[model samples]
Target: MFIKLLLQVVYITVPILIYYALIRNNASLKRYHSILLGIICGISILLCMSFPISFETGYIMDLRTVPWMISFLYGNISTGIILTIIMLGYRIFLGGIGMFVVFIAYSITLLMILFYFKKYSQFSFQHKMKSVLTLTFINSLLIVSSIHFIFGFSESHYLLFYTVFTFMQLLLTWLTVYMIETFRENDRLQLEMQNSEKLYIVGQMAASVAHEIRNPMTVVSGFMQLLYQSDEIPLKHKEHVKIMTVELERAQAIINDYLTLAKPQADKMEKIDVKEQTSLISQTLSSYALMNGVDLHYHIKSDENFYTFGNPEKMQQVLVNMIKNAIEATLNKKAVTISLSKDNEYIYIDITDQGVGLSEDEIKKIGTPFYSTKEKGTGLGLSVSFSIIRAMNGQIMTTSDMGKGTTFTIKLPQY
Candidate 1:
């Protein structure tokens, strides 16, 4: 009788210990809540072991299952370990050598499987589901086989208990996964809503500027044409008319640039050779660089071609802004280098200038409208460039030292 009492105490204590251990690494839950879960499990296991109610047929009642039920609900390694240890202790105290050996083996296996599932299978929903199913199947087999073979218990009595335990555990496991997926969906929805709001604000600002400039642009173009046609106009006046035409064209370009920024959208993407695209931009800008005393240097990391799906025109705009900035910054410098390269899945375009580099604070403010340091800078160039890159699902990053050179890096997804 004393031995049986000691055996029951060991069985009840093991499950509680396992529950405590599982929660040791989990700091997200409140301390009180974790403690409460362990205490409840311990009490439930203890009650199941002590209650002395045998069936009318004289078949032994099994309260030994309470701890396993707790283990299934928790599904954590620490809880499983405690349950196994407590069960093992109880069986030894009661001098049930066969039952003790079988329980120890099953407990260790279950704990190991649980640990592995948590590590590798936690990253994806599908993996988590498969792992849970595998573990449930193994656990069910352990309980049923132990009762049938090791304890020599009647199959008819314990079979119903095992089936009901499996069903309850399956339901609990499904609920846990479902709750986590719901949280992930909510986070994704919030991000989409914020992006939509930003786009709406940008569109409103762009429309106001376009409305203000269209009439003035048309009047200046018409007046310049009249002055050019009048033969009586002096040479100097003709020269003035020519200047008006050029300035009017520049204003129209500025209006178009602003419109692009306000109504930015994803480009029509196609897979193209990234290296070739970079080469073309460098070649096109080469003449402008020479006239301005800016030497262009192009570098490719390897001889192989790189490919990505993107809008070629939008990519050209991004490259042009970066190169123009480099040229303007390096006014009297000896040379500037435009390096192009690729790794496994990304294409990098770096424009380095030997001229005076900007301070950290200046670099941070570059993407904002009207933030240019140039005497004639509109500040909208870099801002428009930023919008274009983002539309293409790419990023632009910059690094600069106050007196040293500055490097601009543009990264695009490669096919």
Candidate 2:
């Protein structure tokens, strides 16, 4: 029993070893460490399967209860299946094939059923109760009935093994529940830490944007005041006035973008139809895309409304940032396309640019506040948009290749 339990524990230890290396501090070493650990675990498992198991004639006490409990405590169905198969293979080779084979087959079936139930329902009270009761009853009936009908074993011994197995199964279930809960708490805390760090980065970007836009805006404002004060200016120099007016507007637009980044008003969230919002933003930005020598396009997959609860203005801001980025990224290409689709209760908008896409290093630094490849870029645009989308329970994913192009996919929950 001790040897069998040890083998089961060893089988279950593989994922933990891989997980430890996968989460190493140096990401460059993570893949190498994980691969090495996995190989070691695989070899160990294979060696364990080659060991011989011999049963004493007519009445060796059944240690079936031990493996049953161990499998449940581990909670990883794959580990349980592997341990059962390996142990059974060894027993079969030693000529303990008859009832041992049946036992191994039953363990695999139980593992599969438990896994299916858990996947469909998770760890709710009802799920746990159902799993426990089903495991207990099915295992008890199989042991008792099989010993009587097939193996011709005694009732007293069968009852003893049945009681022991039940106890082990119960213990295993409790351990699994506790481990799952502990892991979930750790994951929740880790996610919180990551979010806090992202928020800090966003705050820094906001400060940088304010500093960058303030001076240019002030100069533009002063020039506008000078033009207003000059009543004696000649009408022949009206082109100069037009240039000044356009420049001032551009400065104001920059300032506005900064202000929008600094203050993301979440209170304005409403039931926003994604299709309508994207359509409107596409129309509004069409002229800008054309001026920048890029054709802007929108393709909606569904004619029906794709609705989500968010601030339409905020969503529009996100779309504009993406479209503008696409336009700026395009070099020889003449067009950018925004594709919208819905699946699995998510509304997805993918913006693609046909320019020189981001390099591997650039892609890694993306959404990190103030990181930019553009010469004059403030770099707050995507970072601010990322925060806004996340606050709204959405995500922005990017894929880019150096010589090809870039695609930014925005996924938001649909109502």
Candidate 3:
């Protein structure tokens, strides 16, 4: 009896597990395939039907309970209901004397599970384990009573049958849930590790290039400045000289961003007045905003005190890059707002822009080096900003709708 029960478990588990793995990558398919999966489950039950083992009690024992409960436990409500209906129809069509009794048992189990569906879905593994044990205990009692009354199991076999089947169900259900959860956790960790590897590679390359590029840039910048000052130079040529000087300065700035990312000076950390720093940044960007025909405004939620430990310069650098990005994003609709607020644990700086907002893919790659949304952007702005924020133990949260706008919130731990 035990071997038969174990064999049935293996047969049902194979298809169920394979189906779960195939649908794991596509969440939409998992949502849409529930009914079809249930139908497949109903069809799969033919294996048990063809090789049914009847106990001396005139009752047939099969592994229908595995899929019946699994559908409710892991699948959506529609799936569980459909599975119940299909299984009930199959049982009735098979035309056994215990068909009515099996239908009643299945109905009671489904109704009870449906009642706690939402609550059960929210339970942690430990809590769900306790609930599963309780439910299995209740089902064991029902099974014993049904066999004794409807199918008329002999007294000697009733206890043995109830004990064995209940134990098997409990063991198999726990194993299934554990395996699925483990797979989910492993998938999440693997993705996170891949992202970490990308960041490490980017940082290594940035460090290598920064020092090599900075020296030549300084030499070019110095010569360009000297050329600009020469009275012997033609005025038109000096205009070209000025443009070269400006482009050189921009290149120097980008290189500095890279160097700062590669070698963050940790010893410079100190408590910064977040509100004051935000105000200073806003004031500095005011001219830039006006020149671009964008209304940039800064608001302090209160004169509320908030302090965080970081290199104040780097923190301000992060703010500058983010605010500039916001300003640039305000392409035609020229309104940008920067705000500061404080909670018990963190100081919050929010920059919101009425611009062509980011798409989902763009948002994911916002801080990736060499990836940018702007036509002429080098994309180091946000990438360097991401590094600076991480060095300061802070987070940048952004939300955007494609045409509406974008909001960036910088969260830093309060000292």
All candidates' TM-scores?
A: 0.52, 0.56, 0.57
lDDT of 3 by residue, 174-254 (tens): 776676567656864574466456667766887888778888988988999999999999999999999999998888887
lDDT per residue, candidate 2, 1-415, as tens digits? 5575445444434444444445444556533442443344444444444432222333332324334433433334465556556555655665653545457547755665665553221233455555555665566566556555667756676666556555544554455444444554575457556755865665567567777777877887777667756877776565677677777777676556556556655688799988888889889888888888888888988787799988988888898888888888887437899988875457888899988888655765677656777887767677778767877888777777677789888889888
In candidate 1, stretches whose alpha carbon ends up further than 4 angstroms from where it belongs are: 1-202, 209-212
TM-score of 1: 0.52
- 10 residues in a row with least lDDT, candidate 3: 116-125
Per-residue lDDT over 129-181 for candidate 1, one digit per residue giving the tens place of the 0 to 100 score: 66665665566566556655665656676766556545644554454445434
Local lDDT at 67 for model 3? 63
Which candidate leads in TM-score?
3
lDDT against true structure, model 2: 0.64
Indicate which candidate wins on lDDT.
Answer: 3
